[model samples]
Target chain A: MTASTDPATKEPFERVVQAHGDVVWKVCRGLLPQHDAEDAWSETFLAAMRAWDRFDGDRVRGWLVTIAHRKALDVLRAGARVETREDGPPDRAVEPPGRDLDLWAALARLPAAQRAAVVHHHLAGLPHADVAALTGSTPAAVRKAASDGVRRLRALMTEEPR
Target chain B: MTESTPTEAAMPTVPATPPQRLEALHRRLEAAATGDDAPDVHYRHLDSAVGGLLVAATEQGVVRVAFAREGEDAVLQALADRVGPRVLRTPGRLDAAAAWLEAYLAGRRQPFPLALDTRLARGFRLSVLDRLREVPYGERVTYAQLAASADAPRAVRAVGTACATNPLPIVIPCHRVTRSDGSTGAYLGGAEVKVRLLELERTGRLPD
Candidate 1:
């Protein structure tokens, strides 16, 4: 919820805010609840501004989203640590009331890479080849990740206890 | 084979459900992303070192516009593949944008200098985007005011959607719309841009 300034590359810095800001917000939606999305999003770009010079311009969008993913993962880890310190890890939040909700919960259960692959493919309208490029995996690997993610989600949704 | 129980036999089959709605939403998003890149449309040369080709599109009727930069052929190719491949780089397609944005950056523009193509949207979303465009530069309107302006005051949340799903950000000036309590709501271009745009209009300095 705060803005940071990078002294050396001013406009290019703001331009990053302009260019890939949507991706940051959308990525936040996947990792955090709707209510926390904004907070996580702000943290992502604030971190990005401090690290902007290290970003390769050619792969800027992917770089931004990658950092956002790491930031969000850190938030999730922090939440987990808090839960462990208090009541020994969150269970209710991960398991939900209905099948549809459980599908999203299952998505959250994925290893971050698989989850990101699914998100980058289905929601982001990115092709498998481009997603593979972004994730630094081969296209075949991205396809497998997306398929596995979807398979796990489906299994969670159709489990008999529903 | 054992005789089937009547209750068990009465189960209905689950029909195959098409992913139609999801596909449609994807297409709409892709369309919103690619926009019109016909060379006939005007191209603004941003500071090249910034490293992207930027384009602004306006409704055929008026000239005011929003700016978006999709740099590198790889990303552009990706956008085009999803949205469409027909992109033109016409020189003056963005005349109104250049004028309005220049004035806006210079603290001379208010209430925008053009009309928007809500044709890019439909139904409730179109209504929301249209209302957002009415928001004046330098001044802020609450999401409630935006919904009220559209005559659906109860739909303040929908007003927020209009802002979130805005296809054209700067031109519609969704950044000018905020929470009633003055919190800058979630902005597509990040709250930093929102604050900077506001700061520019207010104190005449784009935040350092």
Candidate 2:
């Protein structure tokens, strides 16, 4: 049978996952802590795979990012009842150590809205409008949060010894 | 903020490198996509006497077997389109089918206990494939004979069509059917593969 004969078929879902995986992870990392980010990332993809048939293949990246945004929010909401350690250098010191600890530590210090704005727009390359929708803010607000987050991140990264 | 100015200049250099955890998370996502904990379609490439074949299976059984010429990516796309998009490259899930194919290609002729998903064919075409399985090993049947066995004697051409489009080719033994004039008809695995499979069954070894 000719490949074009089937209008019902779309590109394979695995390719979508492979292509957008890192971006989804970045979005999750921007919103949640490392462990929770990974969980959200996994949940985003698993949910995507389940709903893949109904998804419009043309906007795969945006759809995936939206799912990731929602999944990350779900993770944050679930953990809201639990008390996290206060945000400070000494408080950050107790986190399980790994490479880029400083980078993640800096990220962890930002207000949640600013962090999401920076991660979604800068790292994930999502439009300010999309980030705004995900974060429940306007595009202009998203831009400001990203700028403020970056300014704070610059301060935080420089304070840490190389 | 002057001390942080240098860091601000470098701030644009947020770790471009993805953390190791992302890769680990991707693997975990793939695992969960194809895990036995869920109902999902699993696929993988297999090397055979013919060439690379993309084999797919669901919880029901072996569903689609596609030759390399058809494109593994295309085959998977079709599966995603036709079947659920829950398909993933899960080699471990195909272990049973692989074992059966390995033994069969090694000239063992072991019957595959795996269930066949015939959703790819329907109506008379589906009946033709079902009839093809009883053709017996080391024996040949004409397209006309296959059609007659399916109780559609006038549909010899339809029988050939069914064989050509058989989703599960080698497993279904469509290679056992030939032209009424004793010529090898078209095969999804190509003519050379058809010849080699017939020779293997006839002489207990592939042709040199």
- Ten contiguous residues with the weakest lDDT in model 2 chain A: A81-90
Candidate 1 stretches with Cα past 4 Å from truth are: A1-162, B1-53, B58-84
Against the true structure, what is each candidate's TM-score? 0.39, 0.82
TM-score of chain A of each: 0.58, 0.82
Q: Write the per-residue lDDT of candidate 1 for residues B1-208, one digit (tens) a residue.
A: 0112121122122122124522332233223323331211222443321122254343353221323332334333332333322222333455565566556656666736464444445788888876666666578899998888899989988778877866566667788888888788777656777777788778865665
DockQ, all candidates in order: 0.02, 0.34
Off by over 4 Å in 2: A1-10, A56-58, A80-102, B1-26, B34-40, B206-208
Q: How many backbone clashes does candidate 2 have?
A: 0
Question: What's the TM for model 2?
Answer: 0.82
Enumerate residue pairs that collide in model 2. none
Across B1-208, the per-residue lDDT of candidate 2 in tens digits comes to 1223232233455454455655677567756765444435678789877788888988788999999998877788778777766677767778888877777877877656778788888999899999988888889999989988999899999999999999898899999999988998788888988999999889877774
